[model samples]
Target: MATLMAVMVFGGAAALALYALAATVLPQASRIAAVLRGQSGNVRFEPLSSLVRAERRIAVRRWAAGSTMTAAALRPREAA
Candidate 1:
């Protein structure tokens, strides 16, 4: 029973250590992959930019409709 308990504790510690290492490394690995792909012109920015713009438009519309947290009052007026 004591041997079994020691083995379980050691396995759990090893698993936790592996998880911590992966959490630190995976994001940096993904970013490096993105940069490498971008260098080959495979990364597209327009879709992301358009999505951001659309989200902003939605937020502005929501604000104009009197949703206080969306900052509708901060939207600039369009000139006639």
Candidate 2:
């Protein structure tokens, strides 16, 4: 029972310390990180069109490859 209480106290202190550190650090960290993101004065949040285009291209390529593989597998093995 005493051990359990000790563990709970230690865990709570550790959590609070971690939370305080993160709270102190995150704002400065994010500001520095955002600079690397190269945000212009105007930041627009929108879905990227290029992502959708690339996804479609990948899907088409996969479908073509799958069809070719299936056709090749369906062919009878040549007798030796």
Candidate 3:
């Protein structure tokens, strides 16, 4: 019973220490440790839709390269 209690207490303390380190120390450490020179004043990221579209194009190109059948052959026939 005593050993179990000691283990639980120590485990909890260790967890708290780790959480404190991540929550408080990590962000400041990154900001302080790195020195940056400004190259661009504005930073713009590509929209999610555009990124997904680019990835889809890449996948289609890969599929086309690997497959023996042409894309037109893979399409379903039109109903009469």
lDDT of 1 by residue, 1-80 (tens): 99999999999999999999999989778667877787543455588899999999998897777755456657788999
lDDT of each candidate versus the true structure? 0.82, 0.84, 0.80
Q: How accurate is candidate 3 locally (lDDT)?
A: 0.80
Residues 1-80 of candidate 2: C-alpha lDDT, one tens digit per residue: 99999999999999999999999988778566777898554455656877898999999998888876866687899899
Give per-residue CA lDDT, model 3, range 14-72, as digits (tens): 99999988899777664545434433444446699798999999999989877888788
Q: Using lDDT as the measure, which candidate wins?
A: 2
Give candidate 1's error at residue 23 in angstroms: 0.7
* Ranking according to lDDT, highest score first: 2, 1, 3
lDDT of 1: 0.82
| Residue 44, model 2, lDDT | 54
